[model samples]
Target: MPAADAGGTPDPLRRLTLADLRRRTSMKWRTYEPDVLPLWVAEMDVPLAEPVAEALTEAVRLGDTGYPAGTVYADALRDFARHRWDWDFPASRTALVPDVMLGIVEVLKLVTGPGDAVVVNCPVYPPFYQFVRHLGRRVIEAPLDAAGRLDPAALESAFARATEGGRRAAYLLCSPHNPTGTVHTEDELADVAARAAARGVRVVADEIHAPLVLPGARHVPYLTVPGSETGFALLSASKAWNLAGLKAALAVAGSAAARELAAMPEEVGHGPSHLGVIAHTAALRHATGWLDSLLAGLDRNRRLLGELLTRLLPGVRHRPGEGTFLAWLDCRALGLGDDPAAAFLDRGRVALNSGLPFGTGGAGHVRLNLATSPEILQEAVRRMASAVPDTGRRTREDP
Candidate 1:
């Protein structure tokens, strides 16, 4: 359980239980069998922020749910970015979409044509490959460095290949990268922007996890870089505030990219939920306190998970990355084969995301969600340790 603050208030995030969480009907809870603990999705187990809940409640009371209108969401994001990230996002250059992935796809369509190459840093977010390919575009790989950080040399190589044959291409960048939780430093992002500019490759950054950056790290919005004036970024309060089910996101265009962004069809804006815009706007505009508390809880959970893994699953190499609630675990040393998530799911009934789908560098890994209560996190590690086969090394007390 989370300790009480100075005011004696219990942390809401730490108060959840497996029994309570299982009652929800989200995919994270419903996809697995009755006894399985599902921790594969990006959903958090925390309750809604007070302001967001109130906003949605008011909307429901007034029956204000209709087509999204006005610039409230964009205005809120502008204020949030200026205050939180020191980025002066122009609300005039923003557009709404259903979610980050869909927004990225629409942006890709605006910037690149069919059969154009799209570069991604591998062991990356799986959907980057899926959505790009789904648009009839070719996917190009730029695998991360061994330490899970972006590799400029690899990216340069990928950009070179992506722009061959005089074909236009785009780089699908994952800011505060998923699965690995690696937050790209400002210097790294600047380098990416510079290289992409030189190679005539447009950069599309997915910054959904921007506001959830843990302590001791900073999130550098890619569009803020000097050479990124033409790049586009996909952002959403959904990820930071756990409003994924609500479905609203913004596609922000850099100063020079406004023309291309304006080219996005108006029909794309129709996909966003009006209530989602309301909830997300309220979150960005008035819920920083709630976001701060959530970040603190996530920071604690990340550190706690590290300690737990050391004790219960020593061979499962892990280092809590800078941001997000996801932890990438190298399970090769556990002798669990290439897809370690499969072994854990079959033996321990703990459903984790398999690494194979992340492509390259992902063969011997599993992505663990660290957004649950401390007790559930502990139990998950214990179950994972117990699931290892007899052929693998075990603790002294193992029967």
Candidate 2:
């Protein structure tokens, strides 16, 4: 258990200096102005750990920047899986993917065809709907329950209906779920696995946010379910380690169906970047303390954000996060009419991920990232409160 400094100071292990973040933002956000606080993207403001940075810097200096070939990152990934999830994944069996979305695209191509239906839980990662439509596959949404938790009964019912309808439906599972931060329990995952297995449906579990789960909340890999050896798992430290620029991810599949679906025979040129492999390996092998610190920082940030919102704006309700640093806020109480995100941006000058894009159920909502510093989180909440009139007085403790 790595810990952060009290009073919201950056932990030395997970220190992401403001200077490096400033430099990185100039190129990435295009709004390099020092005033803007960027919480829109999944990337965190934290600096890379010393070990991870040193590994990449050393690899670059050694002139190791060539086409990746062989087990540079494989062993590190195996060790990471073993230590973090207690799951054994043979290094030899894992496939290197340039990006997680690319792997999802590849799997979609293999499992479904034009007019085939691909089922997704609503208010999901935008890519879940985008990928299926990109490949001419019909997107079928099985929405999460009112509690914002994935409903196993709804999922099972949907699968049975799809099976009866003769439509080939593949499920995309997001754990420690993005945008909402709900961590699926083992029993929930087991039920999903059982449903998919019984219905002859393939499940693509996106466990990218697994590393950010809070202390008490656990993220169960879809493959850990009994008889789920064949389930496909798309995992990467890119989200956890904020290595999105490196463009590296892992695709895990032990079952014959998963293997057959994930394998891309035509794309010989697509492989992991040397820097990505080096950074990933280093982070997995040596950056455990740093990661733990980040998880703690994120958890604290989540609490602080909630407190700020509850004190300042009563109508905007949010359920405390179970995982991930993102929180889904119900802004319907504020009569912003439609597109509350746009109204907030116009009045609050803060850019939040709009809920409508997630699905109909997500309307009148906004997704905020609490992964940044306490200062930034407080400022965002202040701006949001100011944007909307404080008519009601409700605090987190009131309920």
Candidate 3:
């Protein structure tokens, strides 16, 4: 059970039981056999936020399912930014897209061309590599610094090489980044904008996890940084609210980039589902209280995972991230060789995301989801510790 919050209420992650989760048909639960505990994937185990569920129910009752229209989604997001991050943009600066990754593809098209270079910080989200290659664009690697923060030197080198022949290049930045969950700070983002501007590299930021930032973190929207006026940002409530099944996102342009967003083809705006728009907007505007509860829950889980690792696994190194429900564990010390998740699945009956797919610096690491019940997380760590060969646990106590 989750410890009660300051107000004596249990957070969302503990609301569901193992049997309750197995009944669902989502990929997270369905991917593994019933005996295998799933700590991979970004999906949360919590139920829908009340406001979002109410909004969807009301829409269904009124038979409001149809094509997406108007700027309600954008309007809701703008309100959220104003209150949460002290940032603001006019309705004229936003457009609807199918989702964050697809929105990134469209933005990349607006700024780059076929065979051009797209730079990404390595050990990043796997889709960044896959999608860039699928679009006929080359991916240039700029690995993060040792502490998992964006490395300015690496970015400079990558930018220099990407535009070697004066060919157009784009940087696909993940803000409040996935997998590692490193929230880029204002100064870091400012440096990126300046560097990209100096090197003639256009920037497209994916801020899907902005709303998922936990306590002690302030997620700076890339477009809000100085010199970022020409860059673009793509955001959605899908990640923070666990509404991935709904397909809708908003693309926001800085003051100097509005014209580029405006020039997007008319057909490009037809992909968002109306129901998705309603749910996303509802989540942004009305479910903020629920969001607060979720953040509290996820923060607790993050620390809990670290505690379990120290006590049972010992060899694993986990630095609890400042945001999101993902914790990146370095299992190199355990001698798991490149892909420890494979061993965990085969020997421990636990499913975790292999880190190899995240590019450089990913080997010997695994990304674990912290958005589940505390009891389940405890069990998963015990199983993972048992997968290690012949080493006495470095610690012997359970909180």
The digit string of per-residue lDDT tens for model 2 on 268-366 reads: 326667788778888888888787778778777877877787678877878887888788998887777557777767777677778888875788888
C-alpha local distance difference test of each model: 0.90, 0.75, 0.91
* TM-score for each candidate, following the candidate numbering: 0.96, 0.91, 0.97
Name the lDDT value of residue 84 in candidate 1. Answer: 89
> Model 1: what TM-score?
0.96
Over 216-236, each residue of candidate 3 has an lDDT whose tens digit, in order, gives: 989999999999998999999
Candidates 2 and 3 compared: the better one by TM-score is 3
Clashing pairs in 2: 16-47, 230-255
**Candidate 1: C-alpha lDDT:** 0.90
What is the lDDT ranking, best to worst? Answer: 3, 1, 2
Q: How accurate is candidate 3 locally (lDDT)?
A: 0.91
Model 3 ranges with Cα > 4 A deviation: 1-10, 392-399
Name the regions of candidate 2 deviating beyond 4 angstroms: 1-20, 26-28, 31-35, 258-262, 266-271, 392-399
In candidate 1, which residue ranges exceed 4 Å CA deviation?
1-10, 390-399
